[model samples]
Target: MLKTLGFAIICLLLFGRCAQQVSPTGGKKDSIPPNLIQSIPLNKTLNFKENRVELFFDEYVVVDNITQKLVITPEADNPYSYRLNGTSIVLNFKKQFQDSTTYTLNFGDAIKDFAERNPAKNLKLVFSTGSSLDSGRVYGMVKDVQTNKPLFDALVGLYNPTDTLNPAKQKPFYFSRTDSSGVFSIENVQTRNYTMIAIDDKNRNMLFNAKDERIGFLSKPISAGVDSVSYNILMALSDNTPLKVQRTLPKVNNYTVVFSKPIEKVKVTFMNKDSLPYMIENGEQIKFFNVQPHSDTTLVKLSVTDSLETSTEFDQKIAFQAPRGKERQKDQFTISSRPENNRPLANSFSYRLIFNKPVQTIEDSKIELITDSLTHETLKNFKSTWNETHNELTIEGKSFAKDTIKWEIPKGSVISVEGDTLARTLIKHPVLNEEDFGILRGKVIGADTSKLYKHFIIELMDDQYKVIDRQYSSPYNFIHIPQGKYFLRLILDLNDNKRWDTGQVNKGIQPEPIIYLPEKTLIKSNFELNDINITLPKAP
Candidate 1:
């Protein structure tokens, strides 16, 4: 009996220990690995011929995804030519000599073992095919020209200047990723003329598609030879192609243009009596097409033709210049209502106002609500809150009885941290009707509830699911919004950085994770004006 009791106690204790060890609540500790020691031919070597290259590390390291991670410059004819056996990486050239040619192979996040995934970090092997590697190299940092901050993971490439060599037809002779510092370096380049282009590779394909991507180029060709070159590359937006009319909605005074890129200079015009184009006012990027029927129908031709002069001409081709990627500013302010679709006949629904830029202060006097076709009155008992993630201002008040409301943001009412004032009459006449506007509201729960995210964003979408409204909030806070279907998402404002960041290939840092609310939240017309709420998941 005594022996059995002792054995039973031991088993119970062991089981308890095992349960504790395997429990998900018992946090597992992450391991750290050794750093890279050295590499042969040195990084950024210029001019010379050699059949083999080697890299030496301090510890018994292993190569991670060398195949996917290695990027050879001046890309060789035979690309699959490198071998990573253990601590060393070997490269065998398949083709014979090209005189005085410079080559660079960037081992991006590929020099780590299977154990910890610790990266060797920016390990590069550079050599020359001729007696001398080109001594000239260009060094500089890439950034959003407007923001003046380093743009991480921005692919910076060097191209030989030739009108025939477009980004789509050719690959860069040499390339490097912008480091966290937004700095990039291309070395061992021969004495010749080249152009620097930086692209935000939204598609992940190295090629730059002007229609879908953002590109920055030096207006002039750069000459490189004996000296190491340095240049600061400011990426600007480009309008490479004309706007494409996606769909036309003659019913509403609005149509959709699927731009090849985001354009700032958009102008729409109607043909005058002399067949000359007259500008349609208030055109902006993305949502540029407005149909509010300027003047009478008799003044303009209903079936206008393009320069092509096709017989059935309801379409007009407008030349537009897209703003540089760096200069594209996100439109922050959004207006939404609850019960997104099929709003009730009653005017009791609430209205939600969202902003994309951070608001330092909001003057209530500048906000006025007009109801019932012209009863302009100050919203009574209005309350406002600032959301840092969406950079929004949430204003709430008693419900109204009408389905349509004219929301006005007066000049000098909204201010930023820098005290930069919004345009006088920024939103002079924003009309929210039952057919288009909707509200989205949600709560943000952090991975560690005790740890609070600085801010959260809620975005509302139109019928085509484009973001039309947005709201920012604090964790666990509830916001009442308009009646419309919306795709709800949240961003943890970790560094207080206003922008989302992509992962770095060299540093092995994955892009910051954005948490999206599961399923599209729908606000129906019958929903209690104050009863709609949404909850956001935590970032993994």
Candidate 2:
């Protein structure tokens, strides 16, 4: 009995200790990357003639994704093969080194410690089969043209001026990838004239794929021998692919056609113009509604023009079907106000009511406007108008007094298409005083006179870069703006398209330039700011 009791007590004590969950405290993590302690045929070796090279690290290291991370400048026909042995990496050359030429082997983030996987940064080996290494270097940054944001990991390349092959067809002669700051440096250059280009390589392939990649170029070839030879590249989606129809989806109530890319303009027509359907364009899809249901297929012609100004016309056969079962149920009629509920309205702005479908009839007697939630007035004096689609109604008072107003819309007051009636609604709008606004006026000094004749879309943006008000002409004059901190932006309408055109790659045109006022403009209540001048960068 004594032995059994002792065994039970010992088992309970062991189980309790295990259940207490004691965590082993290791002192500190090994955050340091493996250091290169030694190298065979040491770095920057002159007249390097060895067929093999070895790199020894302080700790056991692993080579990761060497095929993608490794690069050899002045590309060779037969590159080296890499192998790992214990705490070292070996490179065996497959061919003899070129005579009197400099070479660079870059192992970008490929060598890391075996335990923690901490990568070794800036692992590059430079040598020459000649007496000295090349002293030329090219440094630059890559940024997005539209947003002016740094593009990380973009590939910058150099090519011989006489090279006939484009970036899409051939890899660059010398290339380097941009770091986190969008900066890239290609050292050991030959100090010759070369054409330079940068691309946001999505596929990790050195070759630029025009179908998806964004590319940028300098207007002239650069001489690498010049002091401080730096160039900034502006990258844009230089897609010049011709627009093609991908597929056509015809449904019971609507017909949709999908294209390979988003189109700028689209037109859908039939043999009988009288039977034209209402068309709506949403990016890459063109939707058609109200096409009379027919038992036989109808030939529909579609013409679309993409952003590149490439136009294509095609014919498709579609059969329209009738709605069945639950599909026949009428869509719920809805109306929403612009200022929403209990929101303040600006004086220059008009109160609007948007409906789901086109409105047919409006009963003026059922609509009432209450001033200060007290005095009731008829809307006969208020000017009301409908938008082109006849689905939005705008109500504007000839002149609004600084006061709160309530709008009461009774059910069935407004009738829309398909015999839909508006629901009851109560909304409030307040007309603010003139003292609550401010004015901003500025002159753009370097806007091209020719392009200004076309127009400059001047915008007044809030602190968050959201446009508050816009004007077409320059010497921006923005009035009746709420008091806030703001800035100015100018969209150069080079093509007079009334929009910023991100250039056409096939035409070799750069995007229309955009300029922003450097300093933030603060608008004080009832204050007018002036004398803010801006200069546009010279056209490329």
Quick one: best lDDT, which candidate? 2
Error of 1 at 58 (Å): 4.5
Which 10 consecutive positions of candidate 1 have the poorest summed lDDT? 304-313
Tell me each candidate's RMSD, in Å, in order: 20.0, 5.0
Tell me the tens digit of each residue's lDDT in model 1 across 1-540: 999999999999998888744335545553555455666666656555566677777655676666666777776675446676666667676655466677777788777754556776656666776656567777888876423457888888888877666775577887877888989887777667887778877664677765545566666678776665678766644434333444432212222344223333332334642222222212321222222223323122233222112122234433333345664343333333343323332343344555333455677765676665566656434665544222444555544534455556666677643345566442222233454433334344443352455554545554454665455654222223356655545545455545444332222233333555456666665353332344434333
lDDT over C-alpha atoms for residue 305 of model 1: 22
Cα lDDT of candidate 1 equals 0.54
Instruction: Return the TM-score for candidate 2, rounded to 2 decimals.
Output: 0.79
Residue 63's lDDT within candidate 1 is 68
323-436: candidate 2 lDDT, tens digit per residue: 666744555767788878767676455678887665678887678887776666666557889865466788886434459877888898888655668778777877666688
